[model samples]
Target: MNPLYSPTAERADNRCEYCHAPELVFNDLFKVEHIVPVSHGGSDNTDNLALACRSCNKYKADFQTGTDPDTQTTTRLFHPRQDEWSQHFRYEEEIGEVQGRTPVGRATSDRLQMNRAAQIAARRLWMQLDLFP
Candidate 1:
């Protein structure tokens, strides 16, 4: 496990900082990921780290920016430490989907594939269990 896992996870309230997926439902601990990858010249500073789910981490990889589906313009992914969840994204309970409210949110949602069918299915289940937002 990453040495920063405990503190990062705690700071994120045991949820993926990007997708807001609760860690409690997963068998594996959520990853402590770089908000900006080292390959992109990011440091290991706490502010640069975020807790991420397997899917989000995998999809995000080393990229920091993505094309906003709506604007068709490049935008940075949501910065957990700098951006507020409510300001960027909203959870639609009826559909178990997360809707982006800003460019960063939209790009992050698309880059991370947050609304994939599997994610929606799991979100619905988590909602039923009252474990999701």
Candidate 2:
């Protein structure tokens, strides 16, 4: 068994940490992503791990920081271990954007490209299922 899988999955209740989709339904398609990539000196500890859907994981690969393309400001990605998700982001249904008011939130949203077309579509589905917050 992969050590990264057990605790990370459990921490998220077997759901995608980002979107909170049930893993049983998304099995084999979900991945354990490092909130801070190892390449950026992140550790293998549980604090650094997050359960992400395949799409999110692939999109977020090896990125510890990013620039807000809209504002042209650089910021660090959201650290699941150090930062609270709710504190950094809010969902806006009317515009379908994950509004980030904090540096942590804005950076993660930008770094992960969280508001991409596909992610927006996924969020809509998750919203219909009452899986999104």
Instruction: State the number of backbone clashes in model 1.
Output: 0
Residue 36 deviation, candidate 1, in Å? 0.7
Best by lDDT: 1
By TM-score, the best candidate is 1
Off by over 4 Å in 1: none
lDDT of all predictions, in order shown?
0.93, 0.73
TM-score attained by model 2: 0.82
List candidate 2 stretches off by more than 4 Å.
19-29
lDDT of 1 by residue, 21-114 (tens): 9999999999989988999998999999999999999999999999899989999999998989999999988998998999998999999999
Where does candidate 2 have its weakest 10-residue lDDT segment?
A: 18-27
Give candidate 1's error at residue 79 in angstroms.
0.4
